[model samples]
Target chain A: MITFYEDALCENCYAVRLLLHMLAVPYTSHFIELYPSRANLQPRFRAINPLAELPVIDDDGVIIAGAAPILVYLAAKHAPGTWYATDTPALAQVTHFLTLAERLSATVGAARRHESGFAPTDLPAAHTGATRLLRGLDAHLWFAEQQGNAWLLPTPHPTIADLACFPHVILCEEGGISRQPYPALRRWCDRVKRLPNFLVMPGVFLTAPPKTE
Target chain B: MPDPTTANLWHPIAACADTPVGTPQRTTLLDTPITYTLHGEGHATAASSSMLPVLIRYGYIWTSLGTPTADLFDIPEYAEPDRRRFNAASVSVHVSAPRAVENFLDMSHFPFVHTGILGAEPHTEVKEYDVETSAERDEVLATRCRFFQPQPSTAADQGAEVEYVYRVPHPNCAILYKSSVIDETRRDVIGIFVQPVSQERVRAHMLVCVLDDRSDDETIKRFQQTVFGQDKPILENQFPKRLPLDPRAESPVRADRVSIAYRRWLSAKGITYGVIPAA
Candidate 1:
């Protein structure tokens, strides 16, 4: 049995959930609220996975942290099917999407680490930086739609690509951003949630100063 | 009412070889990162460390790719003047656990979440099913068999013989279209793969394969955008609640046999999460 650390929402956490369901791998949940942690990494979670990401997966004793690491690990070790491509080229395409998702602002869970006092960035300031980030996301999702759904890359199930973007994209609306105007983007989010294991991510997880509820 | 989230469980999918490339390929029982080009060919390996197919839910999720119809239009709302936007299809929306049940309950979606696509009205069609059962883990398997026909396309061989075989491991299955040719190829399948991030949410990828690579790629992209994009807003409404099983009071039909079977299968495997015994 595997133990997954996640809140009810959190697109990234949802992504991990999505992967678990597709694999039909049974797992227990630890709904870590992420804010009260000393370094964002919960105390017990630190023992299971040094990193404090909510989507950590504890496979019996073998622990993996981060959405990317946990997903890739399961695909490689536990589940074997359409999701993990065998060849290099096919896999490379998936990697490209994963890398790209990290940079997009429209993603559901990407909070300003600096604004939240989590991490510092190379950017000058976050006010304009935030705007730029959201626009960049809208453009990218548009680009995805324009470039043929297959243009960006192709993967069965949500793969790590969708997983990478799930959290930030899902929660972007909570950051005073609305996917409603970005019709295409809005649709993408909706489509993503419909996938098995797709949970809703709340902005409060990464909300400013965290929350009491 | 019980939460839909607790009704099923999913497992990580194993990678498969022969993921068609050239002419849009489909994923196996489980959907993941696999693509095909124009013909029944592409580049992919079974269980490559570079990337592997992961599973979620109890087993009712998969990854697939599709090439939409030849008409490029990223929904008129996307106001981007770029016509060259859009590529191919690589997402599917079926949620079922493998070997857990039979017949995905499409009837419910018709009147509920997917009403727009199905053009269904409210409370119009409530169905009940007569099901046979088999059990495993915290799941079950109810099944029935039938012959299916693929929507004959002009691009397809008119004289082609076809026969479809259905063995639903769970509710995450399709009424597939098949060709009777002894060496017939399979494509245009809606893959089901579930990844459980929490007890409630899962990320699913849906894909469709097209026979004609000659079809304009842009048109296909728009089609995919609309299909997947439409499903997003609706799914946001799902909220899982813990509840005991409702016996007899729940109406079902022959189609339900598959769903029941999948629940049994998961139980036999001890793949429990948040569901009651599918007795």
Candidate 2:
């Protein structure tokens, strides 16, 4: 069984949780308190991961740190073809999106933490960076919709790319980033929410069910 | 030229179900922190430990930072016995209260923001509607508004051309009367009552009064959450955060008749709170 060390509100952690639930992977949760008292920064946790970043997963005692790496690990092991495209070009695109996800974590994630008093940083700078990222994401999704492609990559199903970026985009308002101007981004979120076995955390919400016969 | 007693207006601070008996709930109204308790009747205290005016109506706990200049506006549909009356989840938005109200009064964004649920593409045109300011009631009313909705409500299962009536009775509160799926003769009521937590922060409380026996609270709540969830990000993303009352600040189209009337009404009333004053 995978022992997932995570914080309920952490965006990176949510990415792992999304994949775990989507793949129907059974895992045990080791909840980490992130606010008021930063449990992740403690010495005991430092022993597990010197970086002290959240979302370190222990897969049957095999330790893994960082969200993207863990996602790649899980997909390569469990549902490789559907989630983590192994082909040359698709693999490159997945890697590209994972990098964007890290950028989202640095900007939108930092802004949210600052708003919650979890960390202090330049809020305006974070907002500016997040806005640029979201604008690019919106334009990409708009063009994708024009081609009848729903997911981040032009695959029939969603990749880790969608899962990696979904949390921050869904929860951007908490960090003072608005989704209103991005119609395509909002539509993509709704599609992601309608995915089978989709899980919702506290901040993430469920969309209306798709039309059925 | 906003009224000096702008803070005197009543705003919904909490849902009735949220503030339980003997449990003091902390909330904000117009940037002032308030604590409230419901022991049969509702009582509230400001952060300054002074007693604040409270009114429990429309399934929400209304509070004022100062004495209200007028009584709380009426939603007679809320008193309807057969209606499935409930408070949809309260949403904290990063936009000004006036901006939230203005969005509620708009239908043009439905095809885009709401997509398949409230509206869809290819049916994007918002037909002309009648809008007027009721002098005696001091409210902005838009009548004869119609739109093509894929699913108008939780009870709706198919597409329909929905008729709508919008009322802006207060600066931060807007109510919608839409054609109902259950009872076509009667309109379902949806109200967005905004509490201005600060210049660019608001807690939007939604009240739904509809004649639908097919769906329960959770089903209805989920539908409303889905709809508002789509709007929240857009509301936060709007430039300037606050509603621009100046006609020149943002461009408008023919479909924005109700929104234009709402801005005109706010301008005439000199409501500057949560809005950019016309220069």
Candidate 3:
């Protein structure tokens, strides 16, 4: 049985879960909340993943650390034709998107942790980082619309790039980022919402007893 | 605007704006958007846009029907398309889910998800799918995705009929579909897009279709039943979460062209397609 570690609300974890579901590959989930894990701080968890992230999937001896790599690896092995590019040149493009995606994860992930944590934040630095990331997305989307939907490469199908970018983009609202004015994006979301085997990220419902209650 | 509609035909629907509140207008569903309010008492306006009108000499129009109680298939009226379409084509889907309704055009998932229907290979053929949008192309109310199945061998002709006609999102956002290949006269695809009104409770709309050619309605219904029957459990079981990509971490490929193009389209339109860009 494939056992993947994850948190309930972690954005990247949710992206991974969505990917697994789309592939229709069944796996066991091991909920490992990142907040204050005294027990999992043991050497075993760290051994599985050097970063100690939420989604360190342990499928037998084949341990996968990051959500991005793990997803591509899992899908490549299980649902190869759908998302993976068997071709060499396309693999390089996938690598580029993955690299950029990792940088984004680092920036957005840090900012989110900063907010979720009751700790102090370097406000100006955070803002600068977010602005830069949003700027790249803004230009990319704008240019794509002008071209009537030509991609970085000609795709015969939807690849990991589409799946990888989904979760964080939706969650950016948590950091006060709104994608309202982008008509092409709104339409695209409409399209994503249409695909089968899609899953929305789950989070805590606002209506809950106060800590005291 | 005098005769401003670019469509070759003039399809009229009920003008809910003109109708008084609480009164159900008898309207034909004109490609669904402008549900024709039939009763001359209400508005003769939403007449047959279809060159044909079947069951819709009358029906109720809701200014705001947020959720239906059960699946559209469970509805008695959905059993009869002739009554509603007045001989024109019509289809109903159960729920108003944004995703399931849209999958008809989301050709990306076919290889793994539905390998039986769509052959397991990279189909590089990028033909145009017509979108019926608002005058400004902002609102894609409907789309016509067309594709032809390749001939398997020179001896045997390899052409499979493929067309997924769409209607834009309603309050339910359920994906509704219609097909012309099943029968030139076939109306509607089976299934209703269902959404949960509460956590576990669902609202649905069942669709009926009239198959074309000599194949009776029963044969078409059986075929549809066998096919869509397989998808129901899987989609419903996929609740709560999906495979996460963390684009920040994964690589993309040329085969992802449609997905990449879609992502770009989304990011431009104010839809946050991924978090990688901003971070």
Candidate 4:
């Protein structure tokens, strides 16, 4: 069992919860309100996570913070399947996406914050950064689909790379970036959403199931 | 400024569910910031001096910038006792309100946009449909439309030839009546009530009333959202952003009768806010 600290609408927190639900791990939720009061910055929470950010998990006595690291830690421990890649090439790609997720958090995530008036951020720069990343990802997924690959990496099963990039990409519209130009990216999102036990937050929407035949 | 023709008509500003009681929710309608607080049931008051008139109907908070001469269009099936009516969260799109409504009337994009669910490759043909404008009711109607769908509804077990009838009762609103898998005699009503946030922006409010016994609220809402989710990107990516009213502004084939009728009707009605005028 784990104690999870999260904001209900946090994109990063949504990613961790998606993995948790996929892995069917039981956990107790500690809701941290991040708006109006900025409760996460309170001293009581600062003692647990110095960064004062959400999606921090306490697995027994060990504490893990941030979405990417927590996803890796949870997948390595709970996933009996191929969520986190072990092969050298695949692992490198997975690590690459995990690192890129930070950029997503900085750009798209920051834009959402700026839109919500949570913080004073450069909305234009954030939108530009997000557009560049989304275009790159969309082209990658388009070619991947041409080659009969579904996940981020050319693997049969989806790795943490898919989960890492999903929340940011899907929720980019809140930051003023539209997913409209990226058809392949939108399809990939549908694939991710249709994944077994895929979770949705307030802003994150659901996709229809694939054909049964 | 918002088009006077459209401004005079009522438009949904937000879903009732999105505006919890006692909390003020802010949203833009027709390029104007609208802030409303719900203190008591069915009673809403706006914050600003230029506040628009508010009306709650069909699970949404509708407002009008100018005087409205007509009531909100009726959906008779919504009153059915056995039917389940669900409201999907409001989706914001970069396209104009009319663009969103026009997309709702199109069946050609289902295969490419909503592939594997609403339609699929090789079954991409949209059969001939009849289009008519009812002068008496002032609405556009398209009937006898048929399309091949992989999974027509969440309650559907297999692919089937789905029957459809599309109606455009307002400039920014379109209603869909499709064949029901559970009750063949009845049709599931799905509507897109668009809020024109600006000349090139909209907030789409989805209304669904279905006669299904098996699926739960979450399942039905998810299916509808999934279909609309696929449309959101395409709607946003449309060039010009605003819908063109000229017949020759964009090429149309035999399948676009409904869309053509809709544009012509909009032109006839002098709705100029979210449209490019004919050359």
DockQ of each: 0.02, 0.07, 0.01, 0.11
**RMSD, one per candidate, in order:** 22.2, 9.4, 20.9, 7.7
Candidate 3 error regions (>4 Å): A36-40, A118-121, A146-153, A181-183, A203-213, B1-279
* Candidate 1 CAPRI assessment class: incorrect
The residue pairs found clashing in candidate 4 are A180-B233
Candidate ranking under DockQ, highest first, comes to: 4, 2, 1, 3
Rank by lDDT, descending? 2, 4, 3, 1
Task: Score candidate 2 by DockQ.
Answer: 0.07
Model 4: share of true interface contacts reproduced: 0.00
Question: What are the clash counts of all predictions, listed in order?
Answer: 166, 3, 83, 1
lDDT of 4 by residue, B94-116 (tens): 78888899999999988877778
Give the per-prediction TM-score of chain B: 0.41, 0.96, 0.42, 0.97
Residue-level lDDT of model 3, residues B1-279, one tens digit each, is: 111111221222222222344544333231223333334444333323332331222222222122223222122334564522211111222221322333433555544444444434565343556545343533343345544434211112344645555443222223334444434454344333332222222223233433344544333332333334334333444432221123443355433333333333333333221112323
Which candidate do you rate higher for lDDT, 2 or 3? 2
Model 3 TM-score, all chains together: 0.40
lDDT of 2: 0.84
DockQ of 4: 0.11
| lDDT of candidate 2 over A76-195, digit per residue (tens) | 899988998989999999999999999998998889877644576899999999999999999999999999999999999899999999998998877877889999999999999999
Q: Which residue pairs clash in candidate 2?
A: A179-B233, A180-B233, A180-B234
DockQ of 1: 0.02
Tell me, by lDDT, which candidate is best: 2
**Candidate 3: lDDT of A210?**
25
For B1-53, candidate 1 gives per-residue lDDT tens digits of: 21332222223222122122334432332223343232222233223223333
Best by DockQ: 4
- Compared with the true structure, what per-residue lDDT tens digits does model 4 show for residues A1-213? 799998666789889989999989999877775643356888999999999998899999899999999999999897735998877888889999998888988998899766543565888899999889889989999999999999899989998889998999888876777889999999999999999898766556567688898
- Predicted complex 4: CAPRI docking category: incorrect
